[model samples]
Target: MIDAEGLSIKIGAEAKEFDGEARFSRSQLTLWDRVTQMAIAAGEEAVQSAGLELGDEESLRAGAVVGTSMGGMHTLDENYDLIYRQGKSRIHPFTVPKLMPNAPASHLSMAFGARGPSWAVTTACASSNHAMGQAFQMVRSGALDVAITGGCESQLTFGVLKAWEGLRGMARDACRPFSKNRTGMVQGEGAAIIIFEKLERAIARGAPIWAEVVGFGASSDANDIVQPNQDGASRAMRAALQDAGLGAGEIGYINAHGTATAANDRTECAAIRHVFGEHADGLMVSSTKSMHGHCIGAAGALEMVATLGALRDGVIPPTINYDEPDPDCDLDVVPNEAREVEIEAALSNSFAFGGLNAVVAMRKWRGA
Candidate 1:
């Protein structure tokens, strides 16, 4: 098991407790990568929570859409080390199948017996939101009744860490978003899966309804690859508000894509201000990444877990590790401590590298 605190990298939110051997049978562990294992575990929990049996008829209409930035870094890294470092003649036979980007989604389909439509979305940090958006559109357009969607990532390998170090965007000690003294992002690993089904079907089955996925918006910067574009971020948020048929005033909280990098933090605040205008002052914007660390492709989904908590429990998760506030990110970041405030609507932001951005708008579910 990898020690989260004892890592040579200094800071990482690694899922150290994750063990495929303990969670699955021997045959199951051989074929699936750690990424797929996490995805399957999350998917199974979602299916059980949603009271979905995936019967023959239901399975025919159910589908899965998962997201990830790096698919199977552990598998690839281990095999590469064996070949190049140890001068091995051969690697695992299931290496290719386990490392493919679509492996999570494909494995999820087989696990749940879903057959309608299944695929994986890879958009760096915005991957999960994009995947969930695609699933939402499919269900809204009457293409499918049940959609299992989210993201998974387990990229804490030697090669991945070294590559991140080369980028020099990692904090030495901790993740402190929106803080003036913030260094950069801290890496994390995990998965979060959600089951989305028709409201009527949910009602008929008495399934617990959490929140309604109201709108989705996506945009590309088209200007820079590494740097974040404020204009592109603003456009995506504006598009989400328009799609939700909601005014800026209706959104009470915003789950920011604050990655702790100076450019990302400042750019995101500027975009929020541009989109929300005066309402920006009233928005309880916070970056859960401060606590969970940056999950890369799974960032949006993990933050969605925080966003849903705000909608359901009227408590906003704090942006912990905040020391000194930066003037550039002068927004209500709910620093250091959680706050209780009832909110009816909220938005989750996911702005990624390569100038990709995706936003999801959700509203509290009252009743039919």
Candidate 2:
């Protein structure tokens, strides 16, 4: 459990503290919030992993798209505390730039010299998937040859924790997605960035391809602000399948947007069943949120990492902390323990507040 100024939750997964001075100059650190710093670090790692060199002719065709729910909660909380509690007259000079929703994207673009289509997507929990889907579309449509895309979040602040507590959607002990005994979600903070490149360009550069992004689909429920809609989720999944030119049966695994909340877990299961029909019986579905905690905006990107791992290593990550069977969520959840199974294709699902939903379809990369 994590306590924030006496407001505590059952579980909160926070990233290990890293030395900012080691990673950035003092001036750079002062200008960027933790969210933007984390984004820059993730972007750097992804760029290096892909062996991508920006700031050249290729950079003109590169872009950066990032996502976040609350961009700079820590900075806002601290500043508010200083002003309201301590009677401070002014806040940090860089507060505005650090707290802006697009700071992470803007900083990433500047860091990598990506001059094209740089922006951020803010769709609550579904931000990452929406952002990644947008980047995928741009690359697929020839609008850009490369995209530095993913999500970053550093929202574990006193005010943010209290706000989430007011919603009564946070778990008391653990995150147990799809389990009958599940309580609610546990908050997490982190970042994940991936490089998306045109197929020919990636092959030409001999970059290591983790997985192939085949399709993306997004839809809005237009039904509820907090409650999820099964029809909307099913439609998004079907659209992704259609765009991928694949049948529902072709999807071997699903990285579910299972928040461990009672409504979300049950609703997501119903949506999966509705979309997959009889094939749902054999599909291996799991929510990595059980292990990583619900990362909010970064949830989809982290789950996508798990999905890619399944495709690459033939091992499906488990939905940890699952205690009992859930008849409503009867699909194979691979609960408690990891399972070794070869999966050719998978889908990562993200459903957010305000009924936004996004799904991404991917397959094991067979060298082109």
Residue 74's lDDT within candidate 2 is 73
Model 1, TM vs. native: 0.97
Per-residue alpha-carbon lDDT of model 1 for 38-57, expressed as tens digits? 99999999989888877788
Poorly placed runs, candidate 1 (over 4 Å): 1-8
TM-score of each: 0.97, 0.97
Superposed model 2: Cα runs more than 4 Å off:
1-3, 19-22
lDDT of all predictions: 0.91, 0.90
lDDT of 2: 0.90
In every candidate, how many clashes are there?
Answer: 0, 0
> Model 1: clashing residue pairs?
none
- Residue 309, candidate 1: Cα error in Å is 1.1
RMSD of each: 1.6, 1.3
Superpose all Cα atoms of candidate 1 onto the true structure and report the RMSD in Å to 1 decimal.
1.6
Per residue, candidate 2 scores C-alpha lDDT tens digits across 1-368 of 23555786646887767445579989898888888888888888998989998658888899998889889887898899999999999988999998998999999999889999889999999999999999999999999999999998988877888899899999988999999999999999888999999999999989999999999989999999999999999999999998888889899999999999999989999999899989999899999998888888888888888998999888999999989998988889999999999988999999999999999999988787
